[model samples]
Target: MRVFISGYYGFGNLGDEMLLDALRALLIEYGFRRDELVVLSASPKETEREHALSSFKRGNLLRLFAEIKRGDLLISGPGGLFQDSTGPWSPAFYASHAFLALLKGAKVLIYGQSLGPIKRRVNLLLVRFLLSKASLVVLRDESMSDMVPRNKLLFTPDPAFILSVGEVSGLRDGIGIVFRRWKWDLESLLRVLVKMGFPLTLISFQAEREREDGIRLSKMYGLPFLTPSNWAEALRVLSTFKLVIGMRLHSLIMSAMTFTPFIGISYDPKVRSLCELLKMPFLESPRETFAFSGYIRDIMIKWDRKSEGLKCEVEILREKVRSVFTRSLNLLLGREA
Candidate 1:
């Protein structure tokens, strides 16, 4: 059966790309051939080249409708695509895709997504209607459990948890910082971290805005910058770090995957939710009054214990997440879940 995968792909965002990567990998492991997989991407050429799968431009509605009309299923995300915080367009856009798939008699799997902080009544109603019609709706966290029917809702960790990384030769005894363009007081945080005397590296998770931000931060702080070309490379690089202070959700996710302790700087609810779910320390946004030094000091004092605990938690989470995907895929394909 042909499966059409859709998400925020081809936008140079490593997190979304990692979601696609993990989803594709899991689907393959679950017995789907590469030829049966199709992706809807903003840069279809790049997506096709990178993923070795069939693809078509995301904006081509005629093509999308035609594909769903003939395809067996449509996977609508493993990302936060249903929220209106970014604007109503995002919810409308993703919901419309699922709506089309259902309209054309194709099954819809709302894969590993984080549901809304969708404020607008119209957007929320439309999203709920589309979700109600989906064949399966998997949420990444329990925060929005109320949004989906209990029978339809399955909780799994982010799909990126299933990503595999290779080993790196040289491991570093330093902290890595993953930053993006946010209003947080980064310079002050850097000052506090520098006083702790460990080496610091600026790691970039995205190819565009985040890379530029990393470069600027590296120069400003006289630190080295590293930008991994893909999610595996990012995981390998993160594995070498003793700790990570990250603003990006996937950065912290990779840190956990690598068994590296991380401090999450919550700029969004998704980040905060992940941190809370993992029982990790996270500083809230607009953290001007947050006790940076005290927080770091406490984490450092408990570093070994925390790291060990995180390793155990991640392993358990990995198994549960893998099983969730396997079961969901099995059910979707008419097998026992």
Candidate 2:
């Protein structure tokens, strides 16, 4: 199969990179070779080097159209690609490619998509049209079900939940802290964690502004800083943590994949949603973070007591997510099994 996959690829975001990795693994299991996957990426060269897959500049219309003409299927998403809250132009920009690929006669599958927070009529209209025409639509959470037709949409956990971790070095004796731009006061919380004798490693999942923020915070607090050069490195780093406290979605997801307990700091609904799905404690408001150390202490005691059970729970979630992806792909391929 000649499959053209599109998303926020080529950006140095660990979450989206893991999404692509999971999709590649699933496609390979279905007998699609690496060479058959063509990725539309912002940095095509970097993507080709990293994934060993053919890539084209994401917004290059001629190249995209050429790929669309040759592709048998267009796999879009497993990310928050259709949301406009990130920007006004995002919905139109991301949807245009899928619409064009459909126009070129390739079957389109929207996988693990999180729809809305879309408020504009024109953007909603475009999104509705695209979703209506997609061959299969797999939404990442039940909250997204109201946005699309019940007949076409299937609910699954986030694509990252299906990621399989390889062997990595043993866990280190420290806390892994993942933070993004938020109004929360973290200095007090950091001081409390430090006083408790846990060494800190600040993790940045996005190489853009989040990395810069992590560095600044690390320097200001005298903590060590780590921003993984790629997705694999990120997963490896996550595996070594004793525990993780994160505001970024993928950081928490990686923690779950690595079987490490995490305390989520919600800056977005998606973060809160995932925390709820996992039945974990989260701080919804920034001020509540002042008492975070107490929350961590209580949670860690419970976490240590339930480590084996937690591991099993995460594995069950992984299997469920994998099954959903398998079913979605089969439907797209018109396979009964």
Candidate 3:
């Protein structure tokens, strides 16, 4: 059987690349051969070389359509690809592949995705219609459960939780902060970090777009800047931080996966959702005049308790994420789930 995987791949975004890695790993472990897997990517050559799989350029409609086969499986995401907040184009672009697969009689799986802040009714309608046709829809959370049929909706953890990391031991020091382009007050946040008196590092999750902001922040604040090339390197770096103040959702996910304590700075509902799911501390808006110092102080005081609790929660989530993949793949292949 042939499986065509699609997502925001080969774009130099660590989080999306990690999602592809975790999903591909799960598929292979579940009995699919490497040769049977194909990926649709922006950089086909890099995707093929890095993942060791066949690939097609995501923007080449002719090639993408030519490769679809009836009875083949199309796995459409594990990211927030259906949102219109960035623009209407993103939802339309990702949906086109799934729609094409459906038209070609291939089974479509909307795998572990987050639904919208889709402000436009037309975009919402289009997404609803696409979900209606999918053979299976597994969401990363229940926030958008209303959009999917109850019988077809199953909630699971983000696939990044399935990534492998080495065992961490001993006391960890320093603080890691991940930043993206958002409307948050950086100076105020930095004041709190300085008061906390830990060595701070600004980590870039998407270097292509975030490197400029990271460099400016590093220079202004006299902090170190790190741009990890891949997910494994990012995880390794995050594991060394005693505490991570993150703006990226996957940064917190990686921190939890490494059993490192984290505080989320929520610029989106998805970040808040992850914090709620894992029961962690988050600042809804650091831009507001909230008592930022006290918040960090409180977390530091309860550090041991939070770390132990997060480790337990991560283990439970790992099992749930694995089970979701196993059952979904079984059902798709017509075996008893």
Candidate 4:
């Protein structure tokens, strides 16, 4: 079976990359060979290098049409494909891709997709029309159910919940703080974390670090300066953290897979939604982040899943994921298993 996935595949975001990784694993289990899975990769070079298993194709209008027509099963999103409450380009663009794929007669499955505050009427109608014909719809949150009505819109948490952090060498036992989105106030937050005896590693993005803050943070805490451009290396650093206080969506999601404790600093509903699905505690308003040390300390005591036997919460999540994957795969294949 050819399983075509439309996501932020070419985008350098670590969360999107991790979600694709999880999707590939699930695809392997769902009967697609490694060669049969093709990604509409935005960064073809990064996708090719990091995702060595899957086939990569440039995600253009032509390539998009071609992939949809070619694949037997086209799963549009297990990433933040349809969310645009935060951005302008993504929601309509990705949803249109999914719509076109469905129009082309592909077994379009909205897997682990998060619905959003769509502003465009055209986009909304397009999505509604497309999703109405979906073989199966697996949404990530309860909030999405009100917006997108599907006969099979079964709820499953984000796929990242089931992800197991890979084996890596450089990961030391330290606290991971990913500051991709909160670049504006990251300095203050970093200072507070460092002041509280927490060693930090800033996950750099397109924005350059302020020279003053960099010097101050380095001098004060003597923390590690980790700048990973690729996703796998990012995960390596992510796995090293005993607990991750992450601002980026995927950073929190990735942390959850390691079974490490996560404190989410979210600017989007998708972030809160993802945390809710994983049953992870979130650090909501950044205005209150200086108080996070206490919150972390208290939670760590109760975040004792590994300290004891297998946690019941994790087991329940695992079963839910397996069921979603099974049901979605069966429905897409036109089989009632």
RMSD of 2: 2.2
Q: Mark the regions of model 4 whose C-alpha exceeds 4 Å error after superposition.
A: 53-58, 120-122, 166-174, 182-184, 204-222, 229-232, 277-279, 300-312
Candidate with the larger TM-score of 1 and 3: 3
Q: After superposition, how far is residue 151 of candidate 2 from its true place, in Å?
A: 0.4
| TM-score, per-candidate, Cα-based | 0.93, 0.92, 0.96, 0.82
Error of 4 at 132 (Å): 2.3
Tens-digit lDDT string for candidate 4 (225-329): 566775566767677766787777777755655556677876667778766756666766657765677767765667566322223455577667877887777
Indicate which candidate wins on TM-score. 3
lDDT of 4: 0.67
Q: Model 1 segments beyond 4 Å from truth? A: 168-170, 288-290
Alpha-carbon lDDT, every model: 0.83, 0.80, 0.86, 0.67
Evaluate residue 240 in candidate 3 and report its C-alpha lDDT on the 0 to 100 scale: 85
Candidate 4: clashing residue pairs, number: 2
Model 4 weakest lDDT span, ten residues long:
204-213
Ranking of all predicted structures according to lDDT, beginning with the best and ending with the worst = 3, 1, 2, 4
Higher-ranked by lDDT: 1 or 4: 1
> Model 2, 316: alpha-carbon shift in Å?
1.5
